[model samples]
Target: MNALSVIDDLKRRFPNEPEYIQAVEEVLTSIEDVYNENPEFERYNLIERLCIPDRIFAFRVSWVDDKGKVHNNMGYRVQHNNAIGPYKGGIRFHSSVNLSILKFLAFEQTFKNSLTTLAMGGAKGGSDFSPRGKSDMEVMRFCQAFIQELWRQIGPDTDVPAGDIGVGGREVGYMFGEYKKMAREFTGTFTGKGYEFGGSLIRPEATGYGNVYFLLEMLKTRGLSIEGKRVAISGSGNVATYTAEKLLSLGAKVVSMSDSDGSIYVPDGLSQEQLDYIFKLKNIYRGRIREFAEEYECQYFEGERPWQHVACDIAMPSATQNEIDGDDARALIANGCIAVSEGANMPSTPDAIREFQKARILYAPGKAANAGGVSVSGLEMAQNSQKLSWSAEEVDRKLQDIMTEIHKQCVKYGTEEDGYINYVRGANVAGFMKVARAMMAQGVL
Candidate 1:
């Protein structure tokens, strides 16, 4: 009846995918006793069935390029759960995505959204379509075509998907416009829209900002602050940039950031001008990280990960999943990395997580750390439902509140036998309780 047993039983019964099972096992092993003690959840067999999705949709997305050529990609939608509300998650466009990854994300999202105290269930969908090197018109056309088939399976109050890797505001607009044209219902069908078109102003910066907010809370508990702390951030995308910005505003010196290729380190702390240049390179010009080093007059290491560069007080992994492995974790610990907060889904593998916990570093999982994105998405949903938009300051304040509340809940429920709080367990248990109660209240379908 323990949470570990619940996941272990799934692993045994399934006995098909070892990696996936191990991932679930790591999460469950963190909070096994809670599941064993919860009578309502146990009575419903929630733990055993929580890992399974309700429906999985797969389709082929074939789009023609401007050069009279056709390309086909596989798409997936995993509706992990909907007991509390509709499915809500992001669609990632990466070559590495598959059914297993999407299912893991959805399962994690079910808890992540619940932790935000938002009435959103869990689901994720995307294609293995790489948007890089494609023309704007080409990407738009693909998005339009992608949504054409996906429209039937989603709606405002049903399943809402936002953008992830290889997808952005333009793609969201194309998909939203297509969905509206097809359904003839202009509702909050999708989030991450442009601000003028029902997107929340803070949504773009929410995940990064939220990760820092959670970190600030963690530091506060230990009577520490981000002041003068050296921060090393991975990924030069929206999450990493905004996270570094927030940390900089809090008086922390951000020393390094990376992309897929390599990393850059500046001794005098990164400047806003450099970040503006980075945005132009990545968001506007779609350039690489090597260019980042050239413009900033910094040291660049090609074919090297960010964690191995140098020491820092805080480490934020805003990059893709499994970016920080055990080696990276050990390096961070050795280099005096005090806090590790994830701005991307499952950025740290199980081994990395174990290393961090063993080192007693303040660690926040992406589900809880990055909840700010969907938290603002929820705010967007409210604005759409009420036909009103709040000011940026108001939205940002609310976001801080949401992140702080999540931190409190995690700490409240995640206390370990040794009095050390495993944020992963705290996040999962806090989220699970809310969703399970909601599901129990709704009765089984």
Candidate 2:
């Protein structure tokens, strides 16, 4: 497979979809050698087939506000692939929800799910309805309307949607309730549901905890540990919150957390009190990071990211895509930062990733690092199917085991002659091989 030719064609076909093009280029470039070694893959046109999604559902979601104002927003669901099992992914509800971003997410999910060793395929859906300042009723109405458009496309054994970005337990609950009312069934059509319902234990904390676990494995490669490490983490959402929680318990000093508004740097590290406040502020009250800075009297950088300012042993980008650019990567490397494990999807740009790879620092891609949420989602499906709920300890044990296996797979495929583990290459190759074999066995669709 000629990676450049395929990328060029994709660029021509999807000129406006830079994110999608970038995602395709990354996977195709990483898997080119292996894909070429098997001529049958080329004859079957597997690369192109995998680049495009199996189907995409676009629709309009109309909801009413508290003042009886009718609002309309675009909604989408991209089912990327189902060669392995049923479709599975998240529903993001940020204003930035576009086809390009969802397409990239679904494409990335295809491989991310493959790495989990779970029987799941790849899919993603969301809408442009920003729930930032909306009241609970407004958000609930929007979620219900959003589900009204695509409820028929998802089911317990078909597609299971979870939470992402702006979607959370509350949003998932609203959607699931609407679906249940519409379909008259109480099934696990959605993961990340409220614990009172059918939500799995530790599902909310899975991504963050999984990221830290993957970082632990990476640290073990150098005979190091997370204890005593000063860490700088971005974002104040579930991923960053639980990442800091696990890190604090492991004795790591978490110095930073941020939001779209800005970042706060706590030079002395955050206390449990501070983290608790943040959890309430963001989750319950829907407040900002600046509020935390004001309460804790920390240095807050408005309209800026936390990467260039925080000097720490580790940097966890749990924010958004393309957040860490080339300059941020160079700053982290120059500041003697040793490792970076992403808790968000595609948080680092290609240039930033190149910087980390050139520096030989332990850098884990989001597909492998941030896959914990979906891993637990797959487990939730299992528990729901059996009509049994696992204990928190049991679920956490399974999550840790999955992360360790993902790391071992990365090492097996990504280890280089220089004794450096290229986790990005390792993850992509390992994930691709699994999906490719499955697709091959199923024959052409």
Candidate 3:
């Protein structure tokens, strides 16, 4: 029942896996007060059981490249917990994909899914394969090779894998096609599919649109609104772009967007035409953010994030984990930033989060704020099960409802004596209580 002691044991057991350990420590620390109050949880040893994954699958993926050269990559799927429902999560393809990262992701997914009120468990799968410069054919071949080892372990009613960072619509199509051939059934075994198939509407835009929805709710708590708020968002992927699109539509100004190379800061804010161009540049052309600067003659900071340099009312770190460190957090606070809604998993480091808490700024964690993507994925499963697809409006309405409910849950658990909401503590405790009760009821399976 001692959270630090449990963390010490985990650290000794998982010495080199900092990501996983960090994830566990964060949740355990946040929920320790409630966890200690429940003698049933301690008697059942739920913390130890919940920290470890139910199972992990690792395989070697061998695929041929464009020039007839063979490549080998390590593939992994960590099924963390399925006490609530079937295993569900995304399949990432990046050079940084590893057991530690996937485990951390899966652990977070457990609570994220619980917050959705959906029937899904936590799981994550990926390979250390980079698709940046690979040809379409080469990527297709790699997808097939990766699925050859994964197909048997996944299904629509079991573990449904969707797309992540390096895996997109194209990769999902390639892998789903291969899964169809291998399984000989055209079920919704995968999500984020093209509309030509059984894909749900608004699935692609769910995460970004949902992030803005949560941000608006947070702003409401302060008697403010998204209208005319200047925003700085990191990452040029789907989450960032569509978040900008949503923010622009709501009359908010999006001042910055970035990729791995650098950031483009448009002091005048980006127009719809410019955002369209960016869509073509990154999505269609696979180019960089620097191209935006070249085309629009804006300020481009080479090899720098958009955080420290941009002053805005809101900051959205849609990039990878640990992107915003203590320095970035300090700069954001000093520059008059008011709120941050994470669109990526664990994007803020511990120091950055502390700075935000100390400043008493409105901050939402990734698990609660970014649950829209998976929430819609759960909708996709429902539609597939019933053989029906909802319209875009229906899906959007459902996503907004889910994000609103998640915000309510955070407020329910996270409110303090001074009336300032500690959303991280709230989200962690709210999510953990649900899964913990479920685990206890399931009788330690």
Candidate 4:
């Protein structure tokens, strides 16, 4: 596959896109050996085709604020691939949203969807419109405006987008409303919808729960149990909150949770009451992590992450990408951490991932570990099509089963000769093979 050469060509073609380049480099490096083994793939020139998106929609989202002011923001949708099925991914709405980040996310989603054993391809879209400190009316108006430019490009059997950072049920609801009015039909155009509208029962908790579920399977391989394990989790949003909820129920001690403002640590681990308070604080009141510390009398580190500050047996990076670097990885390993299950996309830098792999700790990448959300989103599409809803228990059971299967794939492909499970290599290769075969059968465009 000439991995280095392909990367060099890409860097020149797509300059100033560190995140996208990093993502492509990682996947290509991992699958180079397998890709080169099959000459048919090269005959189709599939690597370059797979690396670029099929189409990207870029437009301006114009909305009016409560102050009667018009605001304009750039919005984008990158349809990376739809060879296997319809395009599927999430819409992020953070201020940090940019072409590089969205392109990287869409690239990663291509493989993540392949691993789910579901008929879904890959895409991603979002705007740089931050909802923080914005009024409900303003947020709704912005969401509606954002969809105005994207409604024509998406559909139930075409491309379905859920939610990601700075996007939630409320935002989805607003977008769905606008889409319904624009498209003149009601369909499962989006996942992560309000349950009353068509959202799956466990959709919100899927990613977080799936991460813990994957972690459990990893632990099982080593004859380890989650009970009594001290956990340090970053981020206090849906992923981290539900992860802590599931962990507490399974008898794990969660000692830390964080936000963009900082991290809070409870030496004895957070109780159900404490986590509930955090749920209200972050979700309902939209407060910061410092509020959790102030309310519970715990230590709060301002402008810091939880990895190096808190000692634990496990570290889950549930926040944004690159939140953990080499230093954080070393601290976690030195602090007796044995596993890292990512709840956020590409949360660990390359250097940090290398450290985790070198330490031989149980590490699951975000694509494999955090794929539950999209898994259930796929389920949501099924439910919407069948005009039926599954019970909470049914959805949860399916989620667990999906996670177990993903772990098995990682074990089958990622295990090194030295007996260390290189999950990164395993997940990348496993996901790539599925997409590669589908693309080959479909022939080159």
Candidate 5:
């Protein structure tokens, strides 16, 4: 199939859905050569099928606030593909949730799951309801209302949902409890559950830790080490903090962390004590990153990201999608940043990626780098199925191995003539080949 033509047709059909279009264009363009090399894929129209979701579930979620007032929100579930295995992805709860965003996420999830070498498909669901400033009871009621409509469509062996940006362990627990009450059976319909339930060990730290592991592998190719390197990280959530914790344990200096409000830069590098304070500030108190700047007397930038301003040996964008643009990438390269390993999906824009590739710097896309979260979610599914839970060490070891294998796949497919590894091309081609072959073998289903 002609990649540009398909993208044009998609844009025409899906007007105003820039996120989904961008995701589809990126993958299709990256895999165009290999996709054309396979005649069966074109004959079977696999590209068309792969780009469109298998099904979409949209419903209304109505709940009562603490004031006993009623509110209604739109919820959605986009099951993109399940040719390989069951549908697996996160359930985000934010005001930004929409068909376009969820579709983009589901499309990305398909390849991300494939890279994990797991028998899982791509899916994403969420609501337009924001969890910020909501009380516990309000959140619980909203989750229950969401599951009331969703329980009939999902099962452990069908579609399993985890937590995303606004949905955390608390939200997962609330939704799982509602599902259990409705289905009358305790199964692994959800991951990232509380440890007291069927949750797996180190699930929270898996993504961040796995990102570092992948970065270390990339550094190994250039005869470099993370030790003594100054690192700039974005986001103060689970992914960013755990990434910082792991880096510190490995002798790296973490120089920055951020939130929705702004970023905090500690030029001297953050200490364990400072990180602990950040943990309390963000996790416990649910405060902003500026609090850390105030408490530690560091530099704080309001309404800005931590990329162009921070001078570091490494950059990790763990916040959100399209955070690092071309200018930020150019600045990072100009400031001598050597590597970037994404902890959030699609955090780097297309121009930024081009900048990284032009500079020949070690760069990893979110699908390959930030896949540890879903890799561990896959593990959680296995544990729940077998009624067994692995120890923290066992789970951590498996995560490391998965990240290593993903890096190997990227290198295998992404290496250039001059020896610079194009991880974006590598990840897209590798992931697309697997799903394309599977779709072809399944015979137009």
Candidate 6:
């Protein structure tokens, strides 16, 4: 039951993968105590089995641009595990794609998938093609090429990829088209497709909605509510957008939202019209977050980061990994930031997590907090198989229910005798137990 021993085992097993090691290190630390209390986990050697992925696939992708030029990109798929079902996660098309990052993501996805109580496994794949300023034709070509080699390795019953950062509905559509053309069959090979296709409702907002729903459970456990609570969210993507929508719907006042460029503060809650415009700009137009401040009358900052001198009751880091560092965590704590739940993957660094735990602030990891998207992706897979589609409200209700259940599991397993919830421990233990049992049953696959 020694966490350090498990970490040492992982360290030796994965010497070349610092990112994977870093991501799983905290979980190992928490696993020691959980395994001590629950003898079955340690008896089965679950930690050793779950630390490494089943397979890692990397391919070279070459495509031509509009200017009579060819570009080469690297595509990777990390199939973390397959005990429960086929590999399921998002395909992110961004320049930042790397094996280590993908491995870390896939590793986290194993537990995230288990937390959803779904029959999906863990996998993530993508390329290094940055879609930021690419023309539509260029994107289409890139996606087509990316899927050409990928098509052979993926399928509905093999691995289903959704969309992630820099990969929106546009990218999903392009990839799905190519996949269909190459595979010559219409199946749920991908989730997060356009609604006109087989994509399920509420997939776009599921991650954000799930995050707030999980936070709501945490708040409710502490006899608190979101009503009239000033909140700061640090993203403008699908996850951030729907989170904003859900927060507003429940009477919470969102003070600020941001993107990679900068964050903007609107003392008054963002109106529906403003939210609509921002959604169009980011989701459709591929616009930037700073435009929200320029187009609307909100307090704005440029060429900088968020977590400045603002004060709020809750802070949601919806942007990329490590956006909230130790200093940002201190700033939040100083400004009465009582809770933080990540909407983006690894949004908070190790130091930021320590700061929150030191101050006894409610904190939830992205794996558990932002699991709604894949949960709904699982729903989409179900719809595809059953040939039945649910309404947005139905999907949203399921998402809320799953997220609330995850929070309760975290509290039930992670709370101290004094009722202080350590969601990190709770999520790690709860997610680990399911995956470990599955792995043990499967016998070393």
- Residue-level lDDT of model 5, residues 1-445, one tens digit each, is 8999999999999899999999999999989999889888888888999999999999999999999999999999999999899999999998888999999999999999999999999999999999899988999999999999999989998999999999889999999999999999999999999888999999999899999999999999999989999999999999999999999999999999999999999887899999999888877788899888888788999999999789999999998889999999999999989999999989999999999988889999999999999999999999999999999999999999999999999999999999999999999998988988888777867
TM-score, one value per model: 0.96, 0.99, 0.99, 0.99, 0.99, 0.95
**lDDT (0-100) at residue 141 of candidate 5?**
98
What shift in Å separates residue 2 of candidate 5 from its native position after superposition? 1.2
Off by over 4 Å in 3: none
Candidate RMSDs in Å, in order, are 1.7, 0.7, 0.7, 0.7, 0.8, 1.8
- Over 53-135, each residue of candidate 4 has an lDDT whose tens digit, in order, gives 99999999999999999999999999999988899999999899999999999999999999999999999999999999999
Q: Find the number of clashing residue pairs for candidate 4.
A: 0
Per-residue alpha-carbon lDDT of model 3 for 228-298, expressed as tens digits?
Answer: 98899999999999999999999999999999999999877899999999999989999999989999999
For residues 203-266, what per-residue lDDT tens digits would candidate 6 score against the true structure? 8888988999998988987899999998899889888889999998999988888887888888
What lDDT does each candidate get?
A: 0.85, 0.94, 0.94, 0.94, 0.94, 0.86
Candidate 4's C-alpha runs over 4 A off are: none
Model 2, 193-262: lDDT tens per residue?
9888889999999999999999999999999989889899999999999999999999999999999999
- Candidate 2 is scored at a TM of 0.99
Backbone clashes for every candidate come to 0, 0, 0, 0, 0, 0
lDDT of 2 at 180: 99
Q: Is 1 or 2 the stronger prediction by lDDT?
A: 2
Model 1, TM vs. native: 0.96
Position 30, candidate 5: lDDT: 88
Question: For model 6, where is the 10-residue window of minimal lDDT?
Answer: 301-310
lDDT score at residue 251, model 1, on the 0-100 scale: 88
